[model samples]
Target: VGCFHQPSIVLADTDTLQSLPKREWNEGFAEIIKHAGIRDAAMFEEIEEVAQGVGDLPALIQRNVAIKARVVEADETETLGIRALLNFGHTLGHAIEAAAGYGGMLHGEAISLGLRAATWLSLQKSGLAAADGARLLRCLAAFELPLKLPADFDSNALLDIAAKDKKFEQGAIRFVLLRALGDAFVSCDITAEDMRAAILHLHEPV
Candidate 1:
Protein backbone atom coordinates (compact mmCIF):
# COMPACT_ATOMS: atom_id res chain seq x y z
CA VAL A 1 0.00 0.00 0.00
CA GLY A 2 1.05 3.58 -0.59
CA CYS A 3 0.04 6.86 0.93
CA PHE A 4 -0.26 10.21 -0.83
CA HIS A 5 -0.26 13.59 0.77
CA GLN A 6 -0.03 17.19 -0.29
CA PRO A 7 2.07 19.35 1.89
CA SER A 8 0.28 21.95 3.94
CA ILE A 9 1.95 24.58 1.84
CA VAL A 10 4.54 24.71 -0.90
CA LEU A 11 7.03 27.53 -0.93
CA ALA A 12 10.03 28.55 -3.02
CA ASP A 13 12.50 31.33 -2.60
CA THR A 14 13.24 32.32 -6.21
CA ASP A 15 16.26 34.27 -4.94
CA THR A 16 18.14 31.01 -4.44
CA LEU A 17 18.09 30.37 -8.20
CA GLN A 18 20.93 32.89 -8.41
CA SER A 19 23.47 30.33 -7.24
CA LEU A 20 22.71 27.64 -9.81
CA PRO A 21 24.82 27.35 -12.92
CA LYS A 22 23.06 28.51 -16.08
CA ARG A 23 22.36 24.87 -16.97
CA GLU A 24 20.59 24.18 -13.71
CA TRP A 25 18.85 27.52 -13.82
CA ASN A 26 17.36 26.81 -17.24
CA GLU A 27 16.36 23.19 -16.67
CA GLY A 28 13.03 23.89 -15.04
CA PHE A 29 11.95 25.93 -18.02
CA ALA A 30 11.05 22.71 -19.79
CA GLU A 31 8.52 21.91 -17.12
CA ILE A 32 7.30 25.48 -17.16
CA ILE A 33 6.76 25.21 -20.88
CA LYS A 34 5.06 21.87 -20.39
CA HIS A 35 2.69 23.39 -17.86
CA ALA A 36 1.87 26.20 -20.22
CA GLY A 37 1.44 23.83 -23.13
CA ILE A 38 -1.03 21.69 -21.26
CA ARG A 39 -2.98 24.28 -19.35
CA ASP A 40 -2.20 27.92 -19.95
CA ALA A 41 -1.87 28.75 -23.62
CA ALA A 42 -1.61 32.41 -22.84
CA MET A 43 1.58 31.79 -20.96
CA PHE A 44 3.17 30.79 -24.25
CA GLU A 45 3.39 34.44 -25.28
CA GLU A 46 4.87 35.32 -21.93
CA ILE A 47 7.45 32.59 -22.42
CA GLU A 48 8.34 33.97 -25.82
CA GLU A 49 8.80 37.37 -24.28
CA VAL A 50 10.92 36.02 -21.48
CA ALA A 51 13.09 34.19 -23.95
CA GLN A 52 14.16 37.46 -25.57
CA GLY A 53 14.67 39.18 -22.24
CA VAL A 54 14.28 38.57 -18.54
CA GLY A 55 10.84 38.87 -16.95
CA ASP A 56 9.37 38.78 -13.49
CA LEU A 57 11.14 35.61 -12.40
CA PRO A 58 9.40 35.24 -9.06
CA ALA A 59 5.96 35.89 -10.47
CA LEU A 60 6.58 33.46 -13.28
CA ILE A 61 7.58 30.71 -10.88
CA GLN A 62 4.46 31.25 -8.82
CA ARG A 63 2.34 31.16 -11.97
CA ASN A 64 3.86 27.80 -12.87
CA VAL A 65 3.28 26.47 -9.38
CA ALA A 66 -0.33 27.47 -9.56
CA ILE A 67 -0.80 25.71 -12.89
CA LYS A 68 0.68 22.51 -11.45
CA ALA A 69 -1.26 22.81 -8.21
CA ARG A 70 -4.56 22.93 -10.06
CA VAL A 71 -3.78 19.77 -12.00
CA VAL A 72 -2.59 17.93 -8.90
CA GLU A 73 -5.44 19.00 -6.68
CA ALA A 74 -7.92 17.77 -9.26
CA ASP A 75 -6.43 14.30 -9.41
CA GLU A 76 -4.39 13.85 -6.28
CA THR A 77 -3.33 10.25 -6.80
CA GLU A 78 -3.49 10.22 -10.62
CA THR A 79 -6.67 8.15 -10.48
CA LEU A 80 -8.30 10.42 -13.05
CA GLY A 81 -5.30 10.59 -15.36
CA ILE A 82 -5.43 14.35 -15.10
CA ARG A 83 -2.07 14.53 -13.46
CA ALA A 84 -0.49 12.53 -16.25
CA LEU A 85 -0.56 15.76 -18.20
CA LEU A 86 2.47 16.59 -16.12
CA ASN A 87 4.33 13.78 -17.89
CA PHE A 88 4.05 15.41 -21.32
CA GLY A 89 7.70 14.94 -22.17
CA HIS A 90 8.71 12.43 -19.51
CA THR A 91 7.45 9.34 -21.33
CA LEU A 92 10.61 9.12 -23.37
CA GLY A 93 12.63 11.45 -21.19
CA HIS A 94 13.15 8.93 -18.42
CA ALA A 95 14.27 6.29 -20.89
CA ILE A 96 16.85 8.63 -22.36
CA GLU A 97 18.07 9.49 -18.88
CA ALA A 98 18.59 5.81 -18.15
CA ALA A 99 20.23 5.35 -21.55
CA ALA A 100 22.66 8.08 -20.54
CA GLY A 101 23.44 5.88 -17.51
CA TYR A 102 22.16 8.66 -15.27
CA GLY A 103 25.23 10.92 -15.58
CA GLY A 104 26.58 13.68 -17.82
CA MET A 105 23.06 14.29 -19.14
CA LEU A 106 20.81 16.45 -17.03
CA HIS A 107 17.17 15.47 -16.51
CA GLY A 108 15.93 18.58 -18.29
CA GLU A 109 18.23 18.00 -21.22
CA ALA A 110 16.83 14.51 -21.66
CA ILE A 111 13.36 15.99 -21.39
CA SER A 112 14.01 18.60 -24.03
CA LEU A 113 14.71 15.79 -26.44
CA GLY A 114 11.69 13.94 -25.15
CA LEU A 115 9.67 17.08 -25.58
CA ARG A 116 10.78 17.19 -29.19
CA ALA A 117 9.80 13.58 -29.69
CA ALA A 118 6.41 14.17 -28.13
CA THR A 119 5.87 17.28 -30.18
CA TRP A 120 6.71 15.31 -33.32
CA LEU A 121 4.29 12.60 -32.32
CA SER A 122 1.64 15.19 -31.67
CA LEU A 123 1.97 16.45 -35.21
CA GLN A 124 1.15 13.03 -36.61
CA LYS A 125 -1.31 11.64 -34.10
CA SER A 126 -3.10 14.66 -32.74
CA GLY A 127 -3.44 17.16 -35.60
CA LEU A 128 -0.93 19.52 -34.03
CA ALA A 129 -0.05 22.24 -36.50
CA ALA A 130 3.53 22.56 -37.66
CA ALA A 131 3.57 26.14 -36.46
CA ASP A 132 2.49 25.06 -32.97
CA GLY A 133 5.17 22.42 -32.83
CA ALA A 134 7.65 24.95 -34.14
CA ARG A 135 6.77 27.29 -31.33
CA LEU A 136 7.53 24.56 -28.81
CA LEU A 137 10.83 23.87 -30.51
CA ARG A 138 11.77 27.52 -30.43
CA CYS A 139 11.17 27.52 -26.68
CA LEU A 140 13.54 24.57 -26.26
CA ALA A 141 16.09 26.17 -28.55
CA ALA A 142 15.79 29.47 -26.72
CA PHE A 143 16.83 27.69 -23.57
CA GLU A 144 19.73 26.08 -25.47
CA LEU A 145 18.43 22.66 -24.56
CA PRO A 146 19.62 19.73 -26.63
CA LEU A 147 17.39 19.18 -29.66
CA LYS A 148 19.13 16.13 -31.07
CA LEU A 149 19.27 12.58 -29.83
CA PRO A 150 22.70 11.81 -28.44
CA ALA A 151 24.54 9.88 -31.15
CA ASP A 152 25.32 7.10 -28.72
CA PHE A 153 21.66 6.58 -27.89
CA ASP A 154 20.30 3.25 -29.04
CA SER A 155 16.68 3.29 -30.18
CA ASN A 156 15.91 -0.28 -29.19
CA ALA A 157 17.28 0.27 -25.74
CA LEU A 158 15.32 3.48 -25.44
CA LEU A 159 12.08 1.75 -26.42
CA ASP A 160 12.68 -1.10 -23.99
CA ILE A 161 13.17 1.35 -21.19
CA ALA A 162 10.19 3.49 -22.19
CA ALA A 163 7.96 0.44 -22.14
CA LYS A 164 8.64 0.16 -18.43
CA ASP A 165 7.53 3.71 -17.71
CA LYS A 166 4.85 4.28 -15.07
CA LYS A 167 2.65 5.71 -17.84
CA PHE A 168 2.36 2.30 -19.40
CA GLU A 169 -0.71 0.42 -18.27
CA GLN A 170 -1.58 -3.14 -19.20
CA GLY A 171 1.33 -3.05 -21.61
CA ALA A 172 -0.05 -0.01 -23.47
CA ILE A 173 1.77 3.31 -23.55
CA ARG A 174 -0.43 6.20 -22.52
CA PHE A 175 1.81 8.63 -24.31
CA VAL A 176 1.15 12.30 -23.76
CA LEU A 177 0.67 14.41 -26.87
CA LEU A 178 -0.62 17.84 -27.69
CA ARG A 179 -3.65 18.61 -29.83
CA ALA A 180 -2.68 22.24 -30.23
CA LEU A 181 -0.79 24.89 -28.41
CA GLY A 182 -1.76 24.81 -24.74
CA ASP A 183 -3.49 21.45 -24.99
CA ALA A 184 -2.28 17.96 -24.17
CA PHE A 185 -3.84 14.57 -23.62
CA VAL A 186 -2.81 11.01 -22.85
CA SER A 187 -2.91 8.68 -25.83
CA CYS A 188 -2.90 4.90 -25.97
CA ASP A 189 -2.77 4.99 -29.75
CA ILE A 190 1.02 5.43 -29.87
CA THR A 191 3.11 2.36 -30.66
CA ALA A 192 6.71 1.29 -30.30
CA GLU A 193 7.13 1.80 -34.02
CA ASP A 194 5.85 5.32 -33.80
CA MET A 195 8.31 6.04 -31.02
CA ARG A 196 11.09 4.49 -33.07
CA ALA A 197 10.32 6.74 -36.01
CA ALA A 198 10.44 9.80 -33.76
CA ILE A 199 13.77 8.67 -32.34
CA LEU A 200 15.27 8.37 -35.79
CA HIS A 201 13.88 11.72 -36.82
CA LEU A 202 15.76 13.26 -33.90
CA HIS A 203 19.04 11.86 -35.23
CA GLU A 204 19.02 14.62 -37.88
CA PRO A 205 21.94 16.18 -35.97
CA VAL A 206 20.88 19.47 -34.55
Candidate 2:
Protein backbone atom coordinates (compact mmCIF):
# COMPACT_ATOMS: atom_id res chain seq x y z
CA VAL A 1 0.00 0.00 0.00
CA GLY A 2 2.68 2.46 -0.99
CA CYS A 3 0.34 4.42 -3.22
CA PHE A 4 -2.26 7.02 -2.17
CA HIS A 5 -5.60 7.75 -3.79
CA GLN A 6 -8.21 10.52 -3.54
CA PRO A 7 -11.01 11.49 -5.85
CA SER A 8 -9.77 13.74 -8.62
CA ILE A 9 -13.04 15.64 -8.38
CA VAL A 10 -14.94 15.70 -5.11
CA LEU A 11 -18.32 17.21 -4.46
CA ALA A 12 -19.91 18.54 -1.28
CA ASP A 13 -23.63 18.98 -1.12
CA THR A 14 -24.39 21.21 1.82
CA ASP A 15 -28.10 20.47 1.41
CA THR A 16 -27.58 17.01 2.84
CA LEU A 17 -26.75 18.54 6.21
CA GLN A 18 -30.48 19.11 6.57
CA SER A 19 -30.88 15.41 7.28
CA LEU A 20 -28.56 15.26 10.29
CA PRO A 21 -29.85 15.47 13.81
CA LYS A 22 -29.17 18.85 15.43
CA ARG A 23 -26.37 17.23 17.43
CA GLU A 24 -24.99 15.39 14.45
CA TRP A 25 -25.17 18.53 12.36
CA ASN A 26 -23.04 20.49 14.79
CA GLU A 27 -20.32 17.86 15.12
CA GLY A 28 -18.57 18.88 11.94
CA PHE A 29 -18.08 22.42 13.13
CA ALA A 30 -15.42 21.30 15.56
CA GLU A 31 -13.40 20.24 12.53
CA ILE A 32 -14.08 23.57 10.88
CA ILE A 33 -12.74 25.31 13.97
CA LYS A 34 -9.71 23.03 13.86
CA HIS A 35 -9.06 24.09 10.30
CA ALA A 36 -9.33 27.77 11.19
CA GLY A 37 -7.13 27.41 14.24
CA ILE A 38 -4.35 25.61 12.38
CA ARG A 39 -4.39 26.94 8.83
CA ASP A 40 -6.71 29.87 8.31
CA ALA A 41 -6.96 32.40 11.10
CA ALA A 42 -8.92 34.73 8.88
CA MET A 43 -11.81 32.29 8.98
CA PHE A 44 -12.38 32.78 12.72
CA GLU A 45 -14.46 35.90 12.29
CA GLU A 46 -16.57 34.23 9.66
CA ILE A 47 -16.96 31.12 11.81
CA GLU A 48 -18.21 33.06 14.80
CA GLU A 49 -20.61 34.92 12.60
CA VAL A 50 -21.93 31.93 10.71
CA ALA A 51 -22.13 29.46 13.57
CA GLN A 52 -24.79 31.47 15.36
CA GLY A 53 -27.11 30.55 12.53
CA VAL A 54 -26.47 28.85 9.22
CA GLY A 55 -25.20 31.92 7.45
CA ASP A 56 -23.57 30.15 4.51
CA LEU A 57 -23.24 26.40 4.33
CA PRO A 58 -21.76 25.87 0.90
CA ALA A 59 -18.93 28.33 1.41
CA LEU A 60 -18.04 26.87 4.77
CA ILE A 61 -18.05 23.28 3.55
CA GLN A 62 -15.86 24.21 0.63
CA ARG A 63 -13.38 25.99 2.89
CA ASN A 64 -13.05 23.06 5.30
CA VAL A 65 -12.62 20.63 2.40
CA ALA A 66 -10.08 22.94 0.78
CA ILE A 67 -8.00 23.13 3.94
CA LYS A 68 -7.94 19.34 4.27
CA ALA A 69 -7.29 18.90 0.58
CA ARG A 70 -4.23 21.12 0.77
CA VAL A 71 -2.88 19.26 3.75
CA VAL A 72 -3.28 15.90 2.02
CA GLU A 73 -1.80 17.30 -1.19
CA ALA A 74 1.34 18.31 0.69
CA ASP A 75 1.86 14.86 2.22
CA GLU A 76 -0.35 12.33 0.50
CA THR A 77 0.82 9.38 2.58
CA GLU A 78 1.82 11.28 5.72
CA THR A 79 5.50 10.49 4.95
CA LEU A 80 6.23 13.99 6.26
CA GLY A 81 4.75 15.37 9.49
CA ILE A 82 2.65 18.00 7.74
CA ARG A 83 -0.35 15.69 7.98
CA ALA A 84 0.19 15.42 11.72
CA LEU A 85 -0.84 19.04 12.06
CA LEU A 86 -4.38 17.90 11.24
CA ASN A 87 -4.31 15.87 14.42
CA PHE A 88 -3.95 18.95 16.58
CA GLY A 89 -6.88 18.04 18.80
CA HIS A 90 -7.12 14.35 17.93
CA THR A 91 -4.32 13.13 20.21
CA LEU A 92 -6.24 13.75 23.39
CA GLY A 93 -9.68 13.71 21.81
CA HIS A 94 -9.31 10.15 20.59
CA ALA A 95 -8.17 8.99 24.01
CA ILE A 96 -11.34 10.35 25.56
CA GLU A 97 -13.46 8.77 22.84
CA ALA A 98 -11.82 5.37 23.29
CA ALA A 99 -11.96 5.63 27.08
CA ALA A 100 -15.64 6.49 26.83
CA GLY A 101 -16.12 3.34 24.77
CA TYR A 102 -16.80 4.90 21.38
CA GLY A 103 -20.60 5.42 21.40
CA GLY A 104 -20.37 6.78 24.95
CA MET A 105 -19.69 10.30 23.68
CA LEU A 106 -20.20 12.04 20.40
CA HIS A 107 -16.97 12.24 18.42
CA GLY A 108 -17.33 16.02 18.20
CA GLU A 109 -17.90 16.34 21.94
CA ALA A 110 -14.75 14.40 22.80
CA ILE A 111 -12.81 16.39 20.24
CA SER A 112 -14.07 19.62 21.79
CA LEU A 113 -12.43 18.65 25.05
CA GLY A 114 -9.24 17.72 23.23
CA LEU A 115 -9.18 21.00 21.39
CA ARG A 116 -9.53 22.79 24.71
CA ALA A 117 -6.60 20.82 26.13
CA ALA A 118 -4.49 21.49 23.06
CA THR A 119 -5.28 25.20 23.22
CA TRP A 120 -4.33 25.36 26.86
CA LEU A 121 -1.09 23.51 26.09
CA SER A 122 -0.45 25.95 23.31
CA LEU A 123 -0.73 28.79 25.75
CA GLN A 124 1.74 27.14 28.13
CA LYS A 125 4.24 25.70 25.67
CA SER A 126 3.98 27.48 22.35
CA GLY A 127 3.74 31.15 23.33
CA LEU A 128 0.26 31.40 21.84
CA ALA A 129 -1.36 34.46 23.40
CA ALA A 130 -4.00 33.71 25.97
CA ALA A 131 -6.54 35.79 24.05
CA ASP A 132 -5.91 33.85 20.86
CA GLY A 133 -6.29 30.51 22.60
CA ALA A 134 -9.48 31.70 24.24
CA ARG A 135 -10.75 32.78 20.87
CA LEU A 136 -10.17 29.31 19.48
CA LEU A 137 -12.06 27.78 22.37
CA ARG A 138 -14.81 30.28 21.81
CA CYS A 139 -15.21 29.02 18.28
CA LEU A 140 -15.71 25.50 19.56
CA ALA A 141 -18.20 26.75 22.08
CA ALA A 142 -20.09 28.52 19.36
CA PHE A 143 -21.04 25.11 18.11
CA GLU A 144 -22.22 24.08 21.59
CA LEU A 145 -19.55 21.39 21.75
CA PRO A 146 -18.39 20.20 25.15
CA LEU A 147 -15.25 21.95 26.42
CA LYS A 148 -15.01 20.48 29.90
CA LEU A 149 -13.99 16.88 30.33
CA PRO A 150 -16.67 14.54 31.58
CA ALA A 151 -16.69 14.42 35.40
CA ASP A 152 -16.24 10.66 35.34
CA PHE A 153 -13.30 10.92 32.94
CA ASP A 154 -10.53 8.50 33.81
CA SER A 155 -7.21 10.23 33.15
CA ASN A 156 -5.01 7.18 33.63
CA ALA A 157 -7.23 5.17 31.36
CA LEU A 158 -7.22 7.92 28.81
CA LEU A 159 -3.45 8.17 29.00
CA ASP A 160 -3.11 4.44 28.51
CA ILE A 161 -5.25 4.70 25.43
CA ALA A 162 -3.20 7.65 24.24
CA ALA A 163 0.03 5.76 24.71
CA LYS A 164 -1.16 3.13 22.28
CA ASP A 165 -2.24 5.70 19.72
CA LYS A 166 -0.64 6.02 16.31
CA LYS A 167 0.33 9.59 17.13
CA PHE A 168 2.96 8.36 19.56
CA GLU A 169 6.16 7.41 17.80
CA GLN A 170 9.16 5.81 19.45
CA GLY A 171 9.34 7.27 22.98
CA ALA A 172 8.23 10.80 22.19
CA ILE A 173 4.80 12.33 21.83
CA ARG A 174 4.51 14.43 18.72
CA PHE A 175 1.84 16.72 20.16
CA VAL A 176 0.64 19.52 17.98
CA LEU A 177 1.06 22.89 19.64
CA LEU A 178 0.29 26.29 18.23
CA ARG A 179 2.84 29.04 18.22
CA ALA A 180 0.02 31.39 17.33
CA LEU A 181 -3.43 31.12 15.86
CA GLY A 182 -3.03 29.56 12.39
CA ASP A 183 0.47 28.37 13.24
CA ALA A 184 0.58 24.82 14.57
CA PHE A 185 3.69 22.65 14.94
CA VAL A 186 4.33 19.24 16.39
CA SER A 187 6.35 19.14 19.60
CA CYS A 188 8.20 16.23 21.18
CA ASP A 189 8.72 17.97 24.51
CA ILE A 190 5.34 17.29 26.09
CA THR A 191 5.55 15.06 29.15
CA ALA A 192 2.89 12.88 30.75
CA GLU A 193 2.62 15.39 33.57
CA ASP A 194 1.87 18.16 31.10
CA MET A 195 -0.90 16.08 29.62
CA ARG A 196 -2.28 15.47 33.09
CA ALA A 197 -2.22 19.19 33.79
CA ALA A 198 -4.18 19.92 30.64
CA ILE A 199 -6.73 17.27 31.49
CA LEU A 200 -7.11 18.70 34.97
CA HIS A 201 -7.24 22.22 33.62
CA LEU A 202 -10.35 21.27 31.69
CA HIS A 203 -12.16 20.74 34.98
CA GLU A 204 -11.75 24.38 35.87
CA PRO A 205 -14.69 26.71 35.29
CA VAL A 206 -14.53 28.35 31.90
Candidate 3:
Protein backbone atom coordinates (compact mmCIF):
# COMPACT_ATOMS: atom_id res chain seq x y z
CA VAL A 1 0.00 0.00 0.00
CA GLY A 2 2.88 2.34 0.67
CA CYS A 3 3.96 2.02 -2.92
CA PHE A 4 0.66 2.40 -4.74
CA HIS A 5 -1.89 3.86 -2.39
CA GLN A 6 -2.51 7.54 -2.89
CA PRO A 7 -4.71 9.66 -0.72
CA SER A 8 -7.98 10.64 -2.29
CA ILE A 9 -8.39 13.73 -0.14
CA VAL A 10 -6.23 16.01 1.91
CA LEU A 11 -6.88 18.91 4.18
CA ALA A 12 -4.91 21.93 5.33
CA ASP A 13 -6.44 23.48 8.43
CA THR A 14 -4.78 26.48 10.03
CA ASP A 15 -6.74 25.92 13.22
CA THR A 16 -5.05 22.55 13.67
CA LEU A 17 -1.66 24.19 13.58
CA GLN A 18 -2.71 26.67 16.24
CA SER A 19 -3.19 23.81 18.68
CA LEU A 20 0.31 22.38 18.27
CA PRO A 21 3.06 23.00 20.77
CA LYS A 22 5.41 25.79 19.79
CA ARG A 23 8.19 23.37 18.95
CA GLU A 24 6.00 21.23 16.68
CA TRP A 25 4.61 24.29 14.98
CA ASN A 26 8.14 25.41 14.31
CA GLU A 27 8.97 21.92 13.13
CA GLY A 28 6.33 22.23 10.41
CA PHE A 29 7.87 25.54 9.46
CA ALA A 30 11.14 23.85 8.69
CA GLU A 31 9.48 21.85 5.93
CA ILE A 32 7.75 25.00 4.76
CA ILE A 33 11.09 26.75 4.57
CA LYS A 34 12.63 23.83 2.74
CA HIS A 35 9.81 23.83 0.21
CA ALA A 36 10.31 27.50 -0.54
CA GLY A 37 14.07 27.27 -0.71
CA ILE A 38 14.06 24.32 -3.06
CA ARG A 39 11.36 25.39 -5.48
CA ASP A 40 9.62 28.72 -5.01
CA ALA A 41 11.49 32.00 -4.82
CA ALA A 42 8.31 34.01 -4.40
CA MET A 43 7.30 31.84 -1.50
CA PHE A 44 10.73 32.21 0.03
CA GLU A 45 10.44 35.98 -0.11
CA GLU A 46 6.96 35.84 1.38
CA ILE A 47 8.14 33.62 4.22
CA GLU A 48 11.05 35.96 4.88
CA GLU A 49 8.68 38.86 5.13
CA VAL A 50 6.23 37.04 7.34
CA ALA A 51 8.67 35.06 9.48
CA GLN A 52 6.71 32.92 11.97
CA GLY A 53 3.95 35.17 13.12
CA VAL A 54 0.26 34.68 13.94
CA GLY A 55 -1.02 37.02 11.29
CA ASP A 56 -1.64 34.65 8.35
CA LEU A 57 -1.75 30.98 9.08
CA PRO A 58 -4.08 30.18 6.19
CA ALA A 59 -1.90 31.84 3.63
CA LEU A 60 1.16 30.11 4.94
CA ILE A 61 -0.45 26.70 4.79
CA GLN A 62 -1.76 27.31 1.30
CA ARG A 63 1.64 28.32 0.03
CA ASN A 64 3.32 25.35 1.63
CA VAL A 65 0.74 22.89 0.33
CA ALA A 66 0.85 24.34 -3.17
CA ILE A 67 4.58 23.95 -3.42
CA LYS A 68 4.46 20.36 -2.25
CA ALA A 69 1.48 19.54 -4.44
CA ARG A 70 3.35 20.80 -7.48
CA VAL A 71 6.27 18.56 -6.77
CA VAL A 72 4.14 15.52 -6.02
CA GLU A 73 2.07 16.02 -9.14
CA ALA A 74 5.19 16.06 -11.24
CA ASP A 75 6.74 13.00 -9.68
CA GLU A 76 4.12 10.93 -8.02
CA THR A 77 6.38 7.91 -7.76
CA GLU A 78 9.69 9.77 -7.57
CA THR A 79 10.70 8.00 -10.82
CA LEU A 80 12.02 11.15 -12.49
CA GLY A 81 13.80 12.44 -9.39
CA ILE A 82 11.88 15.68 -9.02
CA ARG A 83 10.12 14.63 -5.84
CA ALA A 84 13.42 13.74 -4.23
CA LEU A 85 14.25 17.43 -4.45
CA LEU A 86 11.96 17.68 -1.45
CA ASN A 87 14.76 16.15 0.58
CA PHE A 88 16.75 19.36 0.37
CA GLY A 89 17.73 19.51 4.01
CA HIS A 90 17.01 15.95 5.05
CA THR A 91 20.36 14.27 4.52
CA LEU A 92 22.17 15.89 7.39
CA GLY A 93 18.88 16.51 9.12
CA HIS A 94 18.24 12.81 9.51
CA ALA A 95 21.76 12.30 10.79
CA ILE A 96 21.25 14.92 13.46
CA GLU A 97 18.05 13.21 14.57
CA ALA A 98 19.77 9.85 14.85
CA ALA A 99 22.75 11.28 16.68
CA ALA A 100 20.40 12.86 19.18
CA GLY A 101 18.68 9.52 19.80
CA TYR A 102 15.63 10.89 17.94
CA GLY A 103 14.40 12.85 20.95
CA GLY A 104 17.00 15.48 21.68
CA MET A 105 15.93 17.71 18.79
CA LEU A 106 12.67 18.15 17.00
CA HIS A 107 12.84 17.07 13.33
CA GLY A 108 12.49 20.61 12.09
CA GLU A 109 15.10 21.91 14.47
CA ALA A 110 17.58 19.41 13.14
CA ILE A 111 16.51 20.18 9.58
CA SER A 112 16.99 23.87 10.21
CA LEU A 113 20.59 23.12 11.13
CA GLY A 114 20.80 20.85 8.10
CA LEU A 115 19.53 23.67 5.92
CA ARG A 116 22.47 25.78 7.08
CA ALA A 117 24.90 23.00 6.28
CA ALA A 118 23.31 22.33 2.89
CA THR A 119 23.38 26.02 2.03
CA TRP A 120 27.07 26.15 2.93
CA LEU A 121 27.70 23.20 0.64
CA SER A 122 25.68 24.87 -2.09
CA LEU A 123 27.83 27.97 -1.80
CA GLN A 124 30.95 25.86 -2.10
CA LYS A 125 29.79 23.49 -4.83
CA SER A 126 26.74 24.85 -6.62
CA GLY A 127 27.49 28.45 -7.55
CA LEU A 128 25.13 29.78 -4.86
CA ALA A 129 26.09 33.38 -4.16
CA ALA A 130 27.47 34.11 -0.72
CA ALA A 131 24.99 36.93 -0.26
CA ASP A 132 22.09 34.62 -1.06
CA GLY A 133 23.38 32.08 1.41
CA ALA A 134 23.63 34.72 4.10
CA ARG A 135 20.11 35.89 3.36
CA LEU A 136 18.78 32.37 3.78
CA LEU A 137 20.65 31.99 7.03
CA ARG A 138 19.13 35.18 8.29
CA CYS A 139 15.67 34.07 7.29
CA LEU A 140 16.07 30.81 9.18
CA ALA A 141 17.46 32.59 12.19
CA ALA A 142 14.38 34.76 12.26
CA PHE A 143 12.33 31.64 12.85
CA GLU A 144 14.37 30.94 15.99
CA LEU A 145 15.40 27.61 14.53
CA PRO A 146 18.54 25.84 15.57
CA LEU A 147 21.36 26.92 13.28
CA LYS A 148 24.33 25.27 14.92
CA LEU A 149 25.17 21.86 16.29
CA PRO A 150 25.57 21.37 19.99
CA ALA A 151 29.05 22.15 21.27
CA ASP A 152 29.61 18.53 22.19
CA PHE A 153 27.91 17.02 19.12
CA ASP A 154 29.73 14.18 17.41
CA SER A 155 30.50 14.83 13.78
CA ASN A 156 31.84 11.35 13.09
CA ALA A 157 28.67 9.72 14.33
CA LEU A 158 26.59 12.06 12.26
CA LEU A 159 28.57 11.09 9.17
CA ASP A 160 28.02 7.43 9.83
CA ILE A 161 24.30 7.94 10.10
CA ALA A 162 24.23 10.09 6.96
CA ALA A 163 25.96 7.34 5.04
CA LYS A 164 23.06 5.08 5.84
CA ASP A 165 20.46 7.51 4.56
CA LYS A 166 17.91 5.83 2.26
CA LYS A 167 18.87 8.12 -0.56
CA PHE A 168 22.25 6.46 -0.87
CA GLU A 169 22.51 4.75 -4.24
CA GLN A 170 25.27 2.90 -6.03
CA GLY A 171 27.87 3.49 -3.31
CA ALA A 172 27.43 7.27 -3.17
CA ILE A 173 25.22 9.55 -1.17
CA ARG A 174 22.95 11.83 -3.15
CA PHE A 175 22.54 15.39 -1.91
CA VAL A 176 20.03 18.01 -2.91
CA LEU A 177 21.91 21.29 -3.20
CA LEU A 178 20.72 24.75 -4.01
CA ARG A 179 21.99 26.73 -6.98
CA ALA A 180 19.90 29.73 -6.04
CA LEU A 181 17.39 30.54 -3.31
CA GLY A 182 14.67 28.50 -4.97
CA ASP A 183 16.51 26.16 -7.29
CA ALA A 184 17.95 22.85 -6.17
CA PHE A 185 19.25 19.63 -7.69
CA VAL A 186 20.43 16.28 -6.54
CA SER A 187 24.03 15.19 -7.06
CA CYS A 188 25.88 12.03 -6.22
CA ASP A 189 29.20 13.89 -6.31
CA ILE A 190 29.10 14.94 -2.67
CA THR A 191 32.14 13.40 -1.02
CA ALA A 192 32.74 12.35 2.54
CA GLU A 193 35.15 15.27 2.82
CA ASP A 194 32.48 17.66 1.57
CA MET A 195 30.06 16.38 4.20
CA ARG A 196 32.71 16.71 6.93
CA ALA A 197 33.31 20.36 6.11
CA ALA A 198 29.59 21.15 6.23
CA ILE A 199 29.16 19.31 9.52
CA LEU A 200 32.16 21.16 10.95
CA HIS A 201 30.53 24.45 10.05
CA LEU A 202 27.65 23.38 12.28
CA HIS A 203 30.02 23.22 15.23
CA GLU A 204 30.88 26.89 14.84
CA PRO A 205 29.32 29.38 17.24
CA VAL A 206 26.13 30.90 15.92
Write model 1 residue lDDT over 1-206, tens digit each, in one string.
98877667778988898899999877878888888888888887878777787667777788898888889989997899899899998888888888888576899988898999999999999999999899988988898888998677788888888887766676568998999988888899787788888888888864
Question: Ten residues in a row with the worst lDDT in model 3?
Answer: 48-57
Model 3 earns a TM-score of 0.91
Query: Which of 2 and 3 is ahead in lDDT?
Result: 2
- Decide which is better by TM-score, 2 or 3: 2
Estimate the TM-score for candidate 2.
Answer: 0.94
TM-score of each: 0.93, 0.94, 0.91
Residue-wise C-alpha lDDT for candidate 2, range 1-206, written one tens digit per residue: 47677768878777888999989877888889898889999888879878877567678778888899999999887889899899989899988888889488898888888999999999999899999998998888788898887688787888888888765666667899899889999899887778888888877867
Kindly indicate the candidate among 1 and 3 with the higher lDDT: 1
Q: Rank the candidate models, highest lDDT first.
A: 2, 1, 3
Q: How many clashing pairs per prediction, in order?
A: 0, 0, 0
User: Runs in model 1 with CA error above 4 Å?
Assistant: 1-5, 169-171
In model 2, the runs with Cα more than 4 Å from the true position are: 169-171
Weakest 10 consecutive residues, lDDT, candidate 2?
Answer: 164-173
TM-score order of candidates, top first: 2, 1, 3
